[model samples]
Target chain A: MLFDNTDFDYEISFLKIPGSDFNKEIRDSKFLSPEEGFLRGNLMKDEYVPYKNLTYFKLTPQNEQETLLLKLMAYSFTINDLNLYLDLNPKDQQTYELFKKYVKEKNRLEEMYSEKYGPMTITETQGSNYNWIMDPWPWDNTGGSMYV
Target chain B: MFKYVKHLNYPINIKKKDLKMAKYLLTQFGGANGELAASLRYFSQKFSMPDEKGKSLLNDIATEELGHCEMICTMVHQLTENATIEELKAAGLGSMYTEHGKGIYPSDSFGNPFTVTYFAVTGDVLADLSEDMAAEQKARATYENLINMTDDQDVIGILLFLRQREIVHFNRFKELYDYYKKKGY
Candidate 1:
């Protein structure tokens, strides 16, 4: 819950960032490309695969599957990040366009990933068996098996 | 009614393990100003908020805080996962180790377990909304301190992202407050 309190620094800067013309302009401008930055990725580096003890899968450089998955994760995460920002900055055309573009890309990649490997989302599952969980867990960026 | 997504919102791929930093971050996870309380407070307050906008704002922000909680836990998990007993003691996680044994426990970095006493659910729309705005700020401040404390770029990047959400949430809560005030609520 690191965030439900009345923060001191937050009180000082609460309305300052959004209300300020300069800050808002910069935020809404295309100058800020949020693609690579702020995307969701584990800080675990090469360790920990959520619940399962690594079946001893040592941290290996991202395989081809991992690389593609990382890209997908980045684009999907960018959408989430921008969506929240857009809620506040509705008039930001650049942000809107970037968001739309990312949406397209994310959709394309999800479709591709689903076809090649497995569903990333519930809707992506082709068959009715709910076999989507058959693939690597989302946090398992290394695509290593817990039993390895 | 929430669908579980098997992932952290902002990622926590900490390359370096540091129990001290993890301990400090524990405050934001289960501490008074942490995400868990934020999520619970807002989610609970939604039922009491008068207007649709205020209700939705509380609902959405509260839900998002749950995601933040996952990320904070990830940080804590990785930070202490590989630490030895001695290292844990040095990082001041000794007491925590005694209690949870390197497992992620929803307590402040100081080993104070989570308690609902940190927040108020006064059922007053204005009062709750006002508190919501202040909660976002405190979160932002905590993120700032976290960023300043850590040298890891990965950690700092996630911190910055979380910090930005606090700003956005504050803005939205402020807007909801203004809207309700204008309506003579």
Candidate 2:
């Protein structure tokens, strides 16, 4: 349908924000940090999202550790989204590099989180005991222990 | 083969405990066109998928469907969270309560457990991809039906997200099918 209109400008246009080259700048400037906030994901860094973002739930007691957990979650979402993009545009180097970077960041954050909190994955369990089933189980609305 | 994401794809915080509505929602949890069946179908279908593109796409979509399943189960759980045996009996969930007792069981609203009869994993690339498109549409219709039956805003929100996801998955599979057809595969 995109090509059906026959009014193709044929311009090589990349994703951009209104005032600035958003895609060009985000490569080096965007990051997963506390002040930047992980709750927004790539949606914010790429596009200037309005106040009404995608997140529907608010986390209680925003702390450094909690921020880290949210960062990992955000990075994972970014990677997952990028993976889908790459499935079709596999040769897009820019996105492929971003995907790799996010995967690394996500792994580091997951490790740090698992070390301090409980293991987010089975491989993160350091002790002899299988701690994957300790608590939370993803359905506990207010529970902190079951972050994946 | 997969890692838990620790959070639902979208937050589901339903506050109501409507057991009749719960029965309706249960159809989405493990019904024929439910999330569990969607995930199982894609995951099982990937083994016979001809190329890596189809395999990985199916894997990720299937994984997302599991998260959808989790969200549906959470909704079902919260709805029945406070219902007592007597209350459940009145609500016609007495048999379900007797079997699972406030826990989630992978079954339809009618208590039919998940079965492979709901899906297929035929090794044909075109046929499997075509089936996926049909599955996504079917799941979307089921969610739309649930949305129509519900008055709870929270349930409606999650159902909307799930329905949108079904549409997305359908489009993706359609793209893959088009690619195969173009290549004369």
Candidate 3:
């Protein structure tokens, strides 16, 4: 086991807008699951264009750590894609609301992930220990190997 | 004003060591149509944008391009790890080893160091956005070529994701361009 406290559940779905039909603009905009959003590199289905019609192979997390990190990546990518859209279409109320929900969920996930897998950013560091310089930095093969 | 995030925008864990592929991938890192140039181009152009939309779009895309730059560097670092001197020479990376020695340098595949000349920042909003759109298309094409060079699934997945990002960026730049045009900016 990588850590003793590895019992956190990660079986939650993400990025679905409730009462989505009310907003005509949002109804036109399609969203992908956080996982698909991360894989496809765009949250908005309309914006994603696959190169050569080749679908990216799905990622399979090997462990709890991998699962948690993948979740974080998915959530982060979704938020980022929405951010770009919001920057251009700032008045889309439903989209903004969805963005807020994703943001809140991402924050919660970050906190949970930090406690289990060390701080991904300096701000997530807790107590007296500085785990920021921990081994397997993002460049290290092992650090980011979860995607493969 | 950037906070450090010790994670990749997309996760990349390449298990194979391919020096030749790394050499080709360098183009995306520092080539003429590379992420570094894209980042700097928008970052420089944002200040001259006419209004909030242009500024926000450029600034935000600039910030995102920095992340892409980091991703490219990380890919280079991992691809070149554990390479021996002979291996580097065999892969036509002897000159790279001579100077950077496995370190990630911002240079194109042809060993030309990164220069601002790779991109231009015209003060005119329409012109800058047009350049940005072209840059994204060029990046997309470059990624396609890179994908063709590699049979490694690990590398291909990343290239595909990045290629998709280029499409998104290009669309955003086009939308901004059209918006500015309609507003007579």
Candidate 4:
């Protein structure tokens, strides 16, 4: 598969470092895997500060729908974190490239998820059926089946 | 313009309902240092940011805070949806029930309605960024307090995730603040 869960190795050498200072900064800012990032609510390892020695909860997906949805959440989180980083350090070409990679993967995952399940966004609804109003809205008790 | 995404940033499926926990969690939805205040604070402050970096960072973070608001509301809703009137009364939400009747309302643990006074937007960049950083800390503390009140692993997990977000956001705001300071903005 072009995009797999293990594709988080963003240490590609093709992306050049624009400057020494920024290069050092990038080297300093280590990243966590998408799954870890999603679980911890942070992409950067240095910035993830646990409160009072408490560990985050582990998510165990019960079925295929949840498994895919979890992947989408992780990728989306990575993309958002990269976006915030890029917003401040726009000149960091390497991180920008990594950001693009996550975005692409997340987009593909979202499409795949929508196709298999129902539309997550109104625009991504597949087929003629308007499944946007499908049951188990995120807030609904039965919605987050995997969460239990 | 914003498009709705049906999925939450994180999944929240609280299989066990706790009315007291729900009452406490509502503070994050409408408290002084809650998600609603955080979102509005950034939304209002972004306009006067010195550069595109500050503007975009504030804008994007504000957008994320809105999502957090939804998450908090969802949690409160799920936690209290199945509770009876007696359960609500015992949980100290009886007064709240008279007001909103199991519906999620923006108010603190004390049932004080959310007000614009909870946040402020000074046109000054440094002051605004400082406030933003402080806001994130306050929020992180609030999440910790909430986590301490609940023993549910499910609720704790979500609270922990949200708390971590505050740390990340604090770092981001501090970075921007430092950048602006270096540039003498």
Candidate 5:
């Protein structure tokens, strides 16, 4: 369900809703009434809607390594999600095994990506001062698309 | 004020319909391992935190937990938007809707509401940090449980993001614990 640059704008529009309060709880308590609780649960599972325009990066020889590194990160997220889901629903033993397999594959790919481009660092080296790395932030395309 | 400090924010777009997930996610939101409980637990324990660094770490982690609460609520709202009564019932959300009627609220996946006892504000830094670390692991496990039940990639993606944060936060607390111990506090 990865939305490309064309659809990223559409998704951002929905994300810009103003004055919405999703964290409100019942009075003097964290529990919602049964009806309220159930309704809230259902709301959390809605489909993705595009809200903003997105810009796609052109793949270049210099960026090939960076691109693969980003892809590995996306894969890492997928594996993490699949692993968590398997824990919630153990009834699907086969799916669980598949998720485990994918996790291993993702790990292998991540290792390859790292070897090719060097590890993604939280810190960057300049002439002297070691500064925290920035860019490809969470909201950026490098965070990867929600739809994949 | 580090120039490169990352400003933590909820990363996804939440819709009106996602409230149901908010309710269920609230189980963790205010439940034993939920952010509300985790925040209070850390904040309360900060009083006895041995050093300035330890106290600062506790404050930072507790504040981050608040953001996690916001993120979960955003997911809940997005999932429950423009939902019908029939749709809500089918999703096992009838109980919560009876009271809030499409409003956002926090409760367990099973509809049991949040209780204060879900968190303890112990004043001991070691005891509190240890509890905080364990809480993060429990939350990671819970996220794993949530991920297993759903086939939705978006939902799974968000849960994965959250689970990773849990691991990161656990590591942060562990570091703080070690620092405190090394200082003999």
Candidate 6:
């Protein structure tokens, strides 16, 4: 039912990503400025959870430049987590060191940005033995949920 | 040096009456595109497999299919429970219903019954992998068709889950095929 012919264009737009062939034109175009490149990369990477309400700025950037940095830090956190938890071996010690270094940087950025807006509570529930209040799972809401 | 070995067994069984659905399930189970034939093909092909990973992949997938056979039998039993002799005959299950009267048995959907000819044990790895891939697609499609026919939510859920598993298994075999091809075996 969701695939009815009339909404095909709208549905197709939802599937576009930088790496996908559908966005080839965007991929080939050069950035107009450093700020543009940074913002474009962040949007393409899609590494941050979008706020539920557009007007709610809690832990979210008010401008494009801050949004780019927030996304960059979030992306770095994901890469570090995967390297620590899933990778077969830590071939480069520097990568692990970099992850540790970035963790601090991310915390600082989160704190600074959140000062202007209310803090974002990423976790919802904590149990005595197990914590279940985590970000929504991948299948729950796709990119709308936390990146991790 | 001896390597550590772990033995695994499928944790299910088929009963006499369960054959009604099994027969239907196996109709495409052993011909050029059937699951039984496909599984046997992969199992035997292990001997000529040049790499440990390839051999392990084929053997594991073939072993899993045996469990799927058991699953189909389980579904058959659940579906045909408590049917009267007359009721079964009326449903066109007379050949099997006459003998077993809702007893589980393995046969094609038409009640031709199962035979050893339903499986093949070809030793060629390439031939066997090709057969396994095709077999998975066929089985997945059959599950989809069966889901559409049944109004039972439980049955539909099971079929959908099984269909998804088949897709996953197909992807794994595809990756294994690519790895083998790259290794030139």
Chain A only: TM-score of every candidate?
0.54, 0.60, 0.76, 0.76, 0.40, 0.33
Per-candidate fnat, comma-separated: 0.07, 0.15, 0.75, 0.71, 0.01, 0.00
lDDT of each: 0.66, 0.68, 0.82, 0.84, 0.53, 0.45
lDDT of 4 by residue, A1-148 (tens): 0122233333431122234353444446577656667877988977767777576766667778877888888888888888898999899988787788778878998999899888888998585888888887877877743343
**Which docking class does model 1 fall in?**
incorrect
lDDT of 4 by residue, B1-185 (tens): 78888888898888788998998899999999999999999999999998999999999999999999999999998898889999999989899999999889899999999999988888989999999999999999999999899889889889988999999999999999999999997
lDDT of 6 at B133: 75
Instruction: Evaluate residue A88 in candidate 3 and report its C-alpha lDDT on the 0 to 100 scale.
Output: 90
Clashing pairs in 2: A148-B6
Best-fitting candidate, scored by lDDT: 4
Candidate 2 vs candidate 5, TM-score winner: 2
Candidate 5 accuracy as lDDT: 0.53
- Candidate 2 DockQ vs. native: 0.15
**DockQ: the better of candidates 4 and 5:** 4
Q: Which residues of candidate 3, in runs, are more than 4 Å off? A: A1-29, A145-148
- Misplaced by over 4 Å in model 6 are A1-148, B1-35, B116-119
Could you give candidate 5's per-residue lDDT for residues A61-88 as a string of tens digits?
2255544443454444444333333333
In angstroms and one decimal each, the interface RMSD of every candidate reads 11.4, 7.9, 4.7, 5.3, 13.1, 18.2
lDDT of 6 at A81: 31
Q: On TM-score, who's better, 4 or 5?
A: 4
lDDT at residue B87 of model 3 (Cα atoms)? 93
lDDT of 4 at B30: 95
**Count of backbone collisions in candidate 3:** 0
